[model samples]
Target: MTLTPNEILALPKVVLHDHLDGGLRPSTLIELAAEIGHELPSTDPDELARIFSDNADAGDLVRYLEAFAHTTAVMQSADNLRRIAREAVVDLAADGVIYAELRYAPEQHVAGGLTLQQVVEAVQDGIEDGVSEALEAGHAIRAAAILDAMRHLDRSLEIAQLALDNRGRCCVAFDIAGPELGFPPAHHREAFQLLRENHMPVTIHAGEADGAASVGEALGLGSARRIGHGVRIHEDIDGFGTDEVSYGVIAQHALDQQIPLECCPTSNVQTGAAPSIADHPMHELRDLGFAVTINTDNRLVSGVTMSSEFGVLVEAGWTKEDLFEATLAAAWGAFLPYDERADLAESVIEGYGIDL
Candidate 1:
């Protein structure tokens, strides 16, 4: 059945792979930049908006990522980080995301002298505040925090420890992000081992800029429970399509492991991972039984939302039922406890008028 963009958005959703820095509101960036005297490419809100547009529309990951330098610059302060997280939750909730797990590299926040613990705790405070506000408005939104260690750096073990320390608190998982190709997950093997020993939930940014080997390494070395943008798994499939398609061992293993692949269509386009929304591997991944779920990797950098991602998928020929399944994939892959994840699945079924 057909569904309009607003209708698609109204169908309750889950966002498993979103970044706190990548989702800031533009006006928030302007205000925080002003308060901190940080020079910007464009101070005017309109110009700033256009700048964001150019970055995303440029279809270049490096250019799109440069925008985060400004955002992270302003967010170095605890108050700014808190406000960004709080506002991000409200925005995600308004977009009908029943649950969200926001990730960011804490080392980036130390520029303003806040300790790693302080940065994580501050974002946690913001998420709690946002969830409370949403609950007050009768929405009952749930939010979790994931600590991301920049892979190019040597702090993975420390960040993993931090997330584990806050595991049952506001924090839910640990991640490794940043440039991927040369800096393999093997670099962070010790950190992943530590997290695995603690039974901590883990997700890794894999297969976006890199290929299947990177994804294999994330699972093999990092022991990632979920793969962030495992789109490159498609590389293993040759001539896949028509009245039939095929899945290689790597792709099939991801399915077998039930490791959710966070497919951010728009962000993939901007990052050169996919040529366009229509070219995304989402359909291929899902059709092959891979746990593929939609996401907004960097909402502000990509200037999109969970709703917008769904809209793009629909525009690319996804059906209402397809969206329902994708939403279920996200809910099922959420880093919540087993009981909580089950509850989310039930809520999603109720929200989407579906079973299972």
Candidate 2:
């Protein structure tokens, strides 16, 4: 049966690349800005939402990123961070996301006199409250934290240590997120080394604004088990067709190592990584044996939901079986323990009424 939009929304989903500061509700943004005496482009929630969507659709990575300034500006205080985080979970649950790992840079939230640790704690508390409320509402949802360090900054090691210190408590993994062109994964080698020494999992933002070289550095130098938006790995493929598609070193390595690529369709299109959903490389990558998983990089900024992402893919010629496979891949690629991941995968398979 062809899956309708509502059917897709009702299906259990998994998300790995969502951003905390990038997914604030438009109404919440306006209210927070008012509390902090910050000026916004528009006071009307609908107009504010349009502004965010339009700014992010600029087709330039740098300009697309400018929209975050408004969202992060309102997320400085502990109360604001907590409220945003909690609401993020509630929102995800409503969209049928059973599991998610929301990432945010703690250093960005400390501008209002809050310490790094304080921001983490506040977000964690909010996540707990969100999970509890979702359960009360009969929506089973679970979320974990992934602490990201800005790649252009010098506090990567500090943030890595923070992630390790809170391992198994709130934080699940360490990530480096920011401008990926100039600041390659090698710039944060010390942080990666710290994570490696502590046996912590790491995911790097690569191959979005850059090329396959960035992805190679992420895997080899940074030891990333997963690549955030590794869409540019397409650049490394030698032959496009003719029965023998040759993979370059980076592409071959990613496929051979079974590293997961968190593919955010709408976000990638908005950032010009792909021209549109039809032109996305995820379908090719998946066919080539790369472990590709779907995600919502930013629900509000990209103006998407997990269900909407699935709908786009389906319109682009994907099948219900393809969506099921992507969800299963996300479950296995999650930062959870082996048993937990296995259980989640099993549940997803059952939810899809399919045998693995």
Candidate 3:
């Protein structure tokens, strides 16, 4: 059965690819920008929200990423960072997200003279505050940080060290996020190697702006435990919709390994990664034995909540069982211990009211 919007909102969810800088509340954005005299496209919260959504709908990854400058501009201070991080958790919890991994580049937040370590600490403080407040409000949500390093920069090794130092404190994984073209994951092999030696989990943004080869580099070079926005893996398939489907070497490898794909359908459509929700490859990939998990890559920028994302999928022919399987896959793919993952799986199964 197709799930209604309210039912979708009540369903327990897990998000592994959310961006902290891209999910700020519109009112908070205006207020933070005002505090620092930063000019915005619109000062009114509603108008500002529309402006962000419209700007990000440019149908190109480079153009879509232009919206982040404004949000990151206002996030240069510890107070602002903490406030945004807290609100992100509270908002996700209100939307029924039981577990979320909010990611952002610490290097991007140091423009105001804060150290990378300071930025991580501030965000962690906010996450703790958000968790306590959400629990008090009758929502039980657990949030963790995934520190990202921009692929276009030269500080990935340093950022990887930062993530390592903050492990178990707040950071759970390290990632590289930026334009997937021109800059391949191999360029940051040193950083990835450092993370590997430290036994830290890594997720790479690939197969979104680029093609399946980029995904191959993420697995082979970066040793990514999860692929962010891997919708482009369809490029390696010979035929998609018929019994004649055949997977390429890379696609076959991913399927054989069951590596999780953090599929963000709305953001993918906006960035021209997918034509539309009706034609997204998430269901097909899942059917073909790939571990596909749904996520909100950027909530405010994409103008979506977890519930709205699932609602759109249901409209596009996904069933309630589809949501359950995807959510379960997300739990299994989370950067937690096996015992923790099992507990999360149990929570999801209980929430869905299904025997699995």
Candidate 4:
């Protein structure tokens, strides 16, 4: 049975791969851009939103990422960073996100002279503010930060330290983002080693612009607890949908470990990772016993919410049970303590009125 729109919206979601810089509200972008004298493709919110959505559908990873320039341009100041973070939480809560780990590269936001620590603090402050506002509004949401270091840059070790230093304050984990092709996770080995030594959770952005080799390196070398946009793990599977399917080394490793795949269907389609949502590997991966979870990689850039992402899956022939499984997997895969993950899983089961 397909879920009704209201049913979809009422389901609790846990988003682990959302980017703070990619989820800005169009109106907020307009206002912040004007304040910073940053020129945008369009000043009108509706028009600007259309431009971002359309441009990001370029079916190319690098082109899809270019939309962030405008969003990040306004996010340089502490106030702007806080506002964006606050709005992200408020928006997610309104969309029925019970828990979220919003991520952003601290190094990117240092353009306005804010130090890395200051950037983390600003985002954490904003998340706390947003959580308070959501609770007061009767939403009851919890949100935190994931500090990211651009993969192509040389500051992964420093960013790893930053995340470790702010472990409980707001930052929960560390990630390496940015263009993924030439700059594999190996380049950030030192940073990954540091985070590994400190026991900081990691989720590497692999198998998106690259392939299964990138994913293997993420797991084997980077010590990733989760794989970001890991849809391309399908590449390592021979005859993915057939009964005679065979798993390659990386695929076998991921399956053996039950590693969570942070699959973003809409963003993956937009980035040309999959031909379309119907053809996406998420459902098949789920059927394969992979830890598959649904996510909105970027709200504004991909023009998706948790509800809308599920809605698209429904349109593509997914049942409500599929949605429930994905949500439960997300709760289990959250970068939270075991008790907290259990709590989140319980919340999901309660929201769905079902038991796994």
Candidate 5:
């Protein structure tokens, strides 16, 4: 009783934590890179695809991030930004994703003489165009940008203000990304505070390369609403043999606080956060009443989709109940406003109606 990737897609799901530049089509990158005179790992499309897949499987965060150089290099222009954003929406729609909060750092795209406002505007224009194209083609799509501040840099507060400035127009949330260890959320406390005062939502990357202490700082210092790859919370669990005692203070707090963990299974495996999807602690975290949502952290990098991700989960022994709960978890944890979030939730449930 196996199902195809398209079958998993038809189940209706929400993507809470996917990156904009990281999900580009390999062919698109090949063309865009050529247009900008950017140095690519290989000129051939198949070679380029291999480069991305290998980097994602490189087993360390720093090595795994080398592939982004090509994506960011070609994405600095208004035309490129708009095209990629439009393609992003169309791609997500094809994968059966109804709503998405795609994130990228505006600072990175400004290298080509365009200002941050121009960058934001370009992305918004492309998103609008893509959604328009999808509807004309009779497909559903809703997308908003989440401006991420690179953790290794010190411009997060600036990025936070930029996201706040574009709140209703294009930006939906502020996220912190980059090397997760050493650079704890405390480093961006100012940005988090700015987001808090402005009532802007914030999601922090934590508990992936680092440990639970880093996740604790993200929660306590950043006041993170949603945690990216909080898989390391498994470190806090004890009594590994029989009746494993995972009821520690932090574990209990996460369950009671109901913070959603953006569990990107394949990316986690690629980045060495988890050995594999089955070895991922998502099952334990979900069973313990924690909100565990599935995601593709980087589609092109990992060579995955929400569809492929679910198929992998099913092959790893996830049942229909598991799929349903994970889908609902992702939809609920989406950064949408209450009404839109509710609409998405209703849409997911209704998708399961009149079974095939």
Candidate 6:
């Protein structure tokens, strides 16, 4: 049976690559900005939402990142951070996400005199509160945090250590997110090494602003088990379906190793990584046997949800089976332990009533 948007929303989904700051409610931004005496681009909630969505669609990664300044500006306090984190889970649960890993850079929130550990704790408290509320509301959702270090900065090791410190508490993994062109994952080699040595999970932002070399370094040097926005890995493939069709070293390694690509179609198009959702390489990657998963990299900025992302894939010619496959891939690619990951995958399969 073909799945409608409502059916897709009802399916148990796993989200691995959503940003915490980028997913704030517009009303919350207005309220938080007012409390902090910070000026906003727009006072009306609808206008502010439109501004974020429009600014993020500026045709390149650098411009797309500029939109975060507004969101991160108001997220500078403990209470505001807690409220945003809690609300993010509530929103995801309402949208039918069963599991999620919300990522944010603690360093960005320290401008208001909060330490990195304090910022993490605040977000953790918010996540717990949100989860409890969702359970009480009968949503049955779970969430974990992923600490991000700005790739252009020199604090990756510190962030990695922080993630290690909070392994089973709230933080589940470490990531480096920023402009990927000049700041490749190689610059954070020490941080990645630390996470690797400590047996912590790592997912690098690569192949979004840059090309296949970035993805290669993420997999080889950064030791990323999953690639955030690895859309440009398509650059490593040649002559699709032609007699000359072949995988370059990086693409072959990613495919052979089953490395998951957190493919965000709307965000990819907004950042010009893909021409459009219909033209995204996710379909090709899945067809080529890569472990590809769908996500909303930024719900507010990209104006998308997990269900809407699935709808985009469907409009791009994906069937319910393909959506189910992506959900299962996300469950397996989750940073949870093996048994827990397996259980999540089974739950998703049962939710979809599939035999995968």
TM-score against native, each model: 0.96, 0.98, 0.98, 0.98, 0.95, 0.97
Give the per-residue lDDT of model 6 (tens digit) for 1-356: 56777888898889999999889998998988898788888889899888778877777556666668888998888899999999999999999999999999999999989999999999999999999999998898889999999999999999999999999997999999988899988788889888889889899999988999999999999999999999999899998644476999999999999999999999999887888887788888899899999999999888889989888788888988898899999999999999999999989999989864
What lDDT does candidate 4 reach at residue 330? 84
Which pairs of residues clash in candidate 6, taking residues 3 or more apart in a chain or in different chains?
Answer: none
Highest lDDT among the candidates is held by which one?
3
**Residue-by-residue lDDT tens digits, candidate 4, 1-356:** 66899988988888888999999999999998998899998999899888888877876656677789889999888899999999999999999999999999999988899999889889999999999999998898888888899998899889999899999877888889988999998898888888888899999999888899999999999999899999999999999988889999999999998899999999999987878988898878989999998889999998889899989999999888888888898888888999999998999899888955
Candidate 1 Cα misplacement greater than 4 A, ranges: 242-246
lDDT of 1 by residue, 92-172 (tens): 998999999999999999988999989988999999999998888777789998899999999999888888888877588
Instruction: Report lDDT per candidate.
Output: 0.86, 0.91, 0.92, 0.90, 0.84, 0.90
- In model 1, what is the error at residue 352, expressed in angstroms? 0.7
User: In model 6, where do residues sit more than 4 Å from their true spots?
Assistant: 60-63, 241-244
* Candidate no. 3 TM-score: 0.98
Model 6 poorest 10 in a row by lDDT: 58-67
Tens digit of lDDT per residue, candidate 5, span 1-356?
66676678777767888898898888889898887777788888778877788878877666678888778888999999999999988888888888888889999999989998899999999999999987787779788888999999999988998998999888988889988878888888899888888889878899998988877787787888889999988776775223657566666677788888999999999988888787788877777678998888888888888888888889988876787777787788888888888888888878756342
For candidate 5, the lDDT comes to 0.84
* Counted clashes in each candidate structure: 0, 0, 0, 0, 0, 0
lDDT of 4 at 348: 87
Put the candidates in lDDT order, highest first: 3, 2, 6, 4, 1, 5
